[model samples]
Target: MIAQVQKPIEEILEYLEGRDKVVLVGCGGCATVFHTGGEPEVKEMADILSRHGKEVLAAIAPPFGEFTCYAPWSSKRLSKYRQEIEECDAILMMTCGDGLQVVRESVIEGEFGLLKRIYPATNPTGHMGGGPALFKEKCQQCGECLLGKFAGICPLTQCTKGLLNGPCGGSQDGKCEADPERDCAWMLIYERLKKFGELDRLREAEPMLKDYSQMTRPRKIEVAPLVLE
Candidate 1:
């Protein structure tokens, strides 16, 4: 899951400068889970903007819920608010960068040039751990899975220094030197491998450098449709 934090109100105010009319677009997916871009947050932003003497034309959550990041779905959902969006000088998106980009694309596709000024109200922090309440950064989404070799532990993310081979010399008493409060990731991996009698695997091969090509920006995958002969 993507994790996000609300942008500072001062920054929001600066972004809203000279835009008297605005529309607030909230996300119901990860943003809602992180308490950043949910309906309540949208309403709160609207109230704050109103207090600042800005007219909030509308505060709405995409009808497609978690799929708001998809341009087609977002365009359809936003179409209902065409009048409100057109009348507004700018749109304040209470979501992560992806959602903001999707909304902006949707607006462009819909020929709503008046709503070209799009702003993000939240800053994406990182990919979060699984489950509803775990907002901790667990995965880096490197496009390569190395958990099999590390005994299910992610050295890249859990380790402060992102060491893949072993615990750094700075590790003292099983704690990381970079952050004394956190246990060393290599230590945890060592213990887990030792318990599973797979400690020998560590010496089997040298750790290879991460393949950054797999994590190139603007990455995408295509699923071919099935054709019956």
Candidate 2:
């Protein structure tokens, strides 16, 4: 999931300058998990704007499973607020850049054809994994899978410097040199491989340089659409 944090209220207020009537849109996916754009946050934002002398035309917050980044879900939920959305001077997206752009391009422009101004209320940190209470960045989406070689550990993301081969001889007492508090990624990989009697795999040399040709931006894939029986 994409990890993010809410932008400062001062920055959000700056975006709302000269705009009286505003519509707030919240996400139900990563934004909710990160406490950035959930239903409660949306309602709180509405109250804040009202207290600031701004007229909040609508506060649209989808449930925990309805993602604002998904056009179908957003379109369906937003349909009820069509009049308010069209009349609002601005739309505040309490979501990551992905959801914000999707709502702006796919919903506002593509579906409604409104040249509406949409602003993001959250700043995305990065793609992360882990749950319930704590989350951490675990993947870089490097377009290459190397877990099979590293005993399921991703050195690129886990390592501070993204070393492809092994530790940089800076680790001390199984702790990372970059961040002494963090465990050394290579040490973890080595221990896991040794436990499984796969230490020889580490000796098997491979290309050290990462092939980033396929790591282009705006990557997309097309698959058959979901059809319910």
TM-score winner:
2
Q: How many residue pairs clash in each candidate?
A: 0, 0
lDDT of 1 by residue, 1-229 (tens): 7788899999999998999999898987888887788878888888999999999998987532555676666666787899888788888988889888877865644546553688889989887877766667788888998899899999999999887777778999999998899999989999999999999978865456788999898987766633422
Residue ranges of candidate 2 with Cα displaced over 4 Å: 227-229
Most lDDT-accurate candidate? 2
Q: lDDT for model 2, on a 0 to 1 scale? A: 0.91
TM-score of each: 0.88, 0.96
Error of 2 at 222 (Å): 1.6
lDDT of 1: 0.82
Candidate 1 is scored at a TM of 0.88
Model 1 residue 21 CA deviation (Å) reads 1.5
Model 1 residue 86 CA deviation (Å) reads: 2.0
RMSD of each: 3.6, 1.4
